[model samples]
Target chain A: MKRFAFFPGCLIPARYPAMEFAIRQVLPRLGIEIVDLEGSSCCPDPIYFKSKDKLSWLAVAARNLSLAEDLGLDVVTNCSGCTATLSEAIHLLEDDILKKKVNDRLGRIGREYKGTTRVRHIATVVRDEVGYERVRESVVRPLEGLKVAIHYGCHLLKPSKIMQVDNPDNPQVMERLVEALGATAIRHRNWYLCCGKACQTEDIPMNMMHDLLTTVKAAETDILGMICPTCFSQFDYGQMKISKKFDEVFDIPPVYYFQLLAFAQGIPYEKLGFDSQRFKPECLLRF
Target chain B: MPEDADRDEPVRVNFRFRRELAQKIEGNLASFCYQCGACVGDCPATTYSSGFNPREIMLKVLYGLEDELLGSESVLWQCTNCYNCHERCPQEVKPVEVIISLKNMLAARGIYPEVVSKIIGTFETTGRTVRITSAIDRQRAKFGLPPLPPVPMDEVRILLEPDTGTDEEE
Candidate 1:
């Protein structure tokens, strides 16, 4: 099994443990091993923290990357925000000047970032490391009739120079992975629009979400498939808020892609924690 | 009437703010923009909010309108940091990064939303954006996951120190 250090950021562990459970359940079965990175903090958040202080953000991110470097393994993150933070840290620390400045801070803490570790989002780990063919072979129950709409989320694919995960404009990583589980992946009209989770303004996120969800609902998909926990929270929990505010009923369930994969791999639906979901993807169990 | 009466006074560019922003990471990427409007087309905030526009923000940045970009009721908070503009910009201006730098400048001036301040406080204390209640562990227990390990805040504190000079040798 290919071993990796797991970096489960704040949201999944605190707000949505189900996504973590799903990742733990599914990755090993596909011949990938995830070891816990003890004492790792938040990716220090990609938005607010970074906006408040870029130097401190880079230092914290570099510290997290150093944990994986010490473990002698590349890091695999379940959350796109964490991936974006760590990945961008790696990209920035490539500059010797910035690396020196950040190291000055890290050196005080008796830790040094040597830029040895590479970070990958779990989606790419499954696509590139685990291979689609292996995922197809591992599936016990095929979601033949289920239609899934994929939400790539912003951080996973954007700032292409930094993320380098997939083609930012026309990404197919999630779609192909969804198809591997025998489900049809539908790309809605507003698929490229962000979930707007980082927008502090109330109306901006509300309206952005309304537009994205309206398209998803129009597509008539059974569930929305996504790889980011932030997007999952926005679409799942934020969906209800948007519906009430817009006076439109949007009943579509938003699911993390790993949960769907775990279900397809025959992990019992009960253990996947769908009960806590605001809009439970009960339709997934039908397969 | 003077021959130059019709001409408006030249706008003064705030070079100090521009220089301070350039010191941050990729903070000066906005200088490359030629008003292509590509970033504006794909920006979610531009689509949803009337006050938030990346092209206009870039134009202001080019002119170094620090008061406009960093003023109270600033529109920078409306940015989603989606990096869609970072992707679509033909000149690779990285408008999102510039906006973040502008936000940092606002933060330096002790100006930011209360929610942002609360999150920063939470992260500074807990090493995580979300507070870890007993219920977080209880929730993890339901999934058979181990309890989260404590963050080494002593080390975190050292990193967070504002003026830890490089000369302090090991």
Candidate 2:
């Protein structure tokens, strides 16, 4: 079994322990050993923190990367935002000039970035490291006949050169993972757009979520699958907010891909955090 | 036109686009953009708000319109950092990186969105953007997971603040 230092970032532990629960339960079964990353700060949020302070962003990320490097394990994260921040930092710091500048900052903390480690999102880790065939063999409850529409959170797939996860335009990694669980992965209109979580300003995130949920509801999707916790919260919870704001009913349960995977692998229902889910995932129990 | 002369201040294109912005992002990918408008065509932000266009921003960057770019209030924030434009751009100019560089410039001047400041402040203090609530703690305990490890705040502060030694050298 391959081992990794799990970087859950700020969201999962703070907002959604259920994602952590699902990840912990599922990754081990797939033959990937997960270790806790102590003393890690936020991926510090790529769009917000990087926008506000570039030097601090690089230094913070380099520190986290070095933590995993010290452990001699590559980093694996469930949050797409963390994946984006750390991976982009790693890619950016490759430049000798920027590396020197960030290292100058790191020197104050007495740490250095050797850039030896690699960062992978949990979904990518599962698909690449565990292999989809092994995932298929492990599924006890094939999510047969369930139609899942994937929100491939922008961070996981974009700036294709840096992320290198899949074809950015025609992404099939999440769909393949969904299929391995015996669900039919369906495509929706707004599948590729940002969850608008980055636009933390006024009505934009709500407006964007409204558009995405409306489109997915129209497409007759059973569940919205996401690899990012922020996207999970946005759609899973944002739909309710959007419904109240627009005065329309939207009852789509947004399930994190790992939660769905754990469920399909028959890791009990209660552990999946279904009750806390805004749209109760009781429907999936029928399968 | 002559009657409105008092209302229109002289168009000052004095602000040159910082070549440093281009260098910071992908090492000169911004200069390779030939203004194909592919990024504009794929941009969702541009679709919703017609005022925000990635192609136009790139043109401004190419033309050294730093004043024009920074003067665009909330226009830079309109980009969701989706990277759709980055993916679609044939020239591989990751416009999102340039957008961020612009935001960093504005942030350095204390001119970013209020929400960004609030979130960053939360990170600076708490090490996480979201505060740990009793409800979150209860949830973790119920799930049988150990409490979250204490944030390395001393190290976080050192990283967030400018290095004193570097400043002294400067």
Candidate 3:
């Protein structure tokens, strides 16, 4: 089995642990081992981009990268924000002058960054390593009856073009994966919309009422399968908001790809963290 | 507005691209904005909240609010950069271009928040963006879990870093 350093970023371990757990149990069956790294700080996310000093933001990310490279492990990122930030830094640190400045700062702690490691989001791993056809073959209890909508969050594909794992405007990696699970892939207009998650901190009400609502209206589906935690929250928790405001009950559930894979593998609902999700298992079994 | 511009001194803001920007990112598409209010008309970023306006900011470029626009937080940070304005623009005057240009300007001028400062400091020290810890190292502690099999970090580095390393000489 091939192994790599796994990074679930700040959100997964605490908020969306289920996605992490599902990925762990399912990937090993495909010969991929995920090594969890501790002492990792917040990827600093988008908030870092707002920083007054680029050098400082670079330093924080650099230290984290150094920790992995020093240990001689490649980074597997789950959070798009972390991947984007880290990917951008890969360019900044490669330059000789900026490299010297960044290193001088970390030199205080005996931390040296050689820029030897790489980062991969989970979706890329599924698409690249576990080819869609292989996944199709691995289906123990294929998702033969379920209709799935693929929501590729912006962070995974935004200023994110350079390190993109798949298409930017019309992505199908998730859809192909859904097909591999033996499920009916449902197409939705809002799948292209941004979850509007990052803006919540900046404009709480507008981000929800306008940005999020707009996407939900376009979703028009039974289940929303997402690759991101922030995106998942927009649909998972955001569903409650839609139900509160609208007339007819709007109850499109949110599911992780790993969960679906685990479910199809006959892994019990408990192991797949079914109880931890906002959408209940019983509610979904109707499909 | 055209007649007013003819009579009144036309206010113009000078925008310069930064060194760090990709010369080809379509970030320069702001040059296509013909002062159409379409971006102002549909932009949630412009009107979603107060003191943050992409259209008004575009007007600032026309009206020459250079220092203020570059120095303002709302213009750059407040925008979700979802490219909604770009998608909705009637004249194809991508407001996103101006936003990117403005952001690049701020980054070059070292006008961003303090966190950027700390991160740049980190980059000078180490070359990578994150740190990873092996899950199997701890046995007695609560963080301890079933020992994970050995992980391969080399391939992951290749995927994320994507030729950022110096392997050409080898």
Candidate 4:
């Protein structure tokens, strides 16, 4: 089994532990082992924290990467925000001057970032580390006839020069993975539109979500599949708020991709923690 | 006309703010933005909000309008930081990075939204953006997952410590 250090960012553990649970349940079955990176903090958040202080953000992110570097393992993150922060930090720290500056701060704690570790979103880990054919073979319960719409939340594919996960404009990584589970992946009209979780303005996120959900609803998909817990929270919990505000009934459940994969791998529905979600993917239970 | 008279005066670009921002982001990427409106086309914030526009923000950055960009009612908060502009910009201006640098400047001036301050406080103290509680462990147990581990605050604190004059040397 290929072993990788797991960096479950703040959101999945705090607000959405089930996603973490799903990841733990699924990855091992696909011949991938997850090693927990204990004592790691938040990716220091990609938006607010980075906007507040770039140098400090880089320091915090570098500290997280340093933990993985000590283990001699590349980090796999469940949240796109964490991946973006850590990946972008590595990209910036490539400069010897910046690395030395961040190292100066890290040196205070007896830790140093040697830039030896690589950070990847779990989606890519599954795609690149474990081939899709292996995923197809591991599935005991196929999601036949289910239509899944993908939300490749911004951080996963953007700043394409740094992320290099897939084609940012027309990404098919999630779609192919969805198909591997025997489900059809539909790319909605506003598939490229961000989930807007980082937008602090109230009306801006609300309207942007309304626009994206409108397209998803029009596509008539069973559930929205996304890789980021932030986007998952926005669509699952925020969907209820958007529904009431827009006077439109958007009942489409948002399922994290790992949860879907776990379900496909024959992990019992009760074990996945769908009950705790505001918008439960009850449709998956029918299979 | 008053508008024409106003235009006649020299537009004084704040070189100090521009130079400071250049130090934060490599190459001062905002200098390369030619205002082709590519970043504006796919911007969700610009699409939904009338006041938030990346192209206009880049124009301000080029002119070094620090007061307007970092004012009390700054529109930078409206940005989603999706990096779509990074993908769309032909010149690789990375408007999102420039906007983030501008936000950092706002924060350095002790000017930012209350929510940002609260998050920063939580992260500094707990080493995580979200506070952990006994209930969080309870939630983790429900899925047969291990209890969440404590963050190394000693190290996080060191990393978060306010710089003591070393940053300006570069």
**Evaluated with TM-score, which candidate comes out highest?**
4
Candidate 4 regions with alpha-carbon error over 4 angstroms:
B1-7, B167-170
Interface RMSD of 3: 9.1
Better of 2 and 4 by DockQ: 4
| Decreasing TM-score order of the candidates | 4, 1, 2, 3
Query: For residues A1-287, what per-residue lDDT tens digits would candidate 2 score against the true structure?
Result: 99999998888887888878888888889999988877888987887788876778888999999899899999999888899899989998888988888887778889888899999988889988999999999899998899998889888988889998898879899999999999999889888877887874556677778888888999898888888887887887777888999999899888888889989989888767789888887879897
lDDT of each residue in A1-287, candidate 1, tens digit only: 99999999998888888888888889889899999998799888989899988888999999999989999999999888999999999999999999999998888878899988899999899999889999999999999989999899899998888998999878889999999999999999999888988888899899889999999999999999988888988998899999999999998988889989999999888889988888989997687
TM-scores for all candidates: the values are 0.96, 0.92, 0.70, 0.96
Instruction: Per model, state how many residue pairs clash.
Output: 0, 0, 47, 0
DockQ of each: 0.75, 0.62, 0.12, 0.78
- Residue pairs with clashing backbones, model 4: none
lDDT of candidate 3 at residue A207, scale 0 to 100: 48
Q: Model 1 over residues B1-170: C-alpha lDDT tens digits?
A: 12233468665677877788887778889889899899988888888888989999998888888778898899999999899898888898889989998888888888999999999999999899998888889999999987777788888878987654442111
Name the candidate, 1 or 4, with the larger DockQ value.
4
Candidate 3's residue-wise lDDT over B69-164, tens digit each? 677464566666565575567666567655655564566566765544565344223222222234322321222234332323332222222123
Q: Which runs in model 1 stand beyond 4 Å of their true positions?
A: B1-8, B164-170
Per-residue C-alpha lDDT of model 3 across residues A1-287, encoded as one tens digit per residue: 66777766655654566666677778887778877665455554644432323445566577778878866888888777788767767766778866876676667556777889887777788788878877777778876767777777766775434465665667778888888888877666545666665552335333444444455556555576777777777677766765666543656678877888877766776566666557664544543
- Record all residue pairs in model 2 with backbone atoms less than 3 Å apart, i.e. clashing: none
Instruction: Give the CAPRI rating of model 4.
Output: medium
Predicted complex 3: CAPRI docking category: incorrect
Docking class of 2: medium
| lDDT measured at residue B164 in model 3 versus the true structure, 0 to 100 | 30
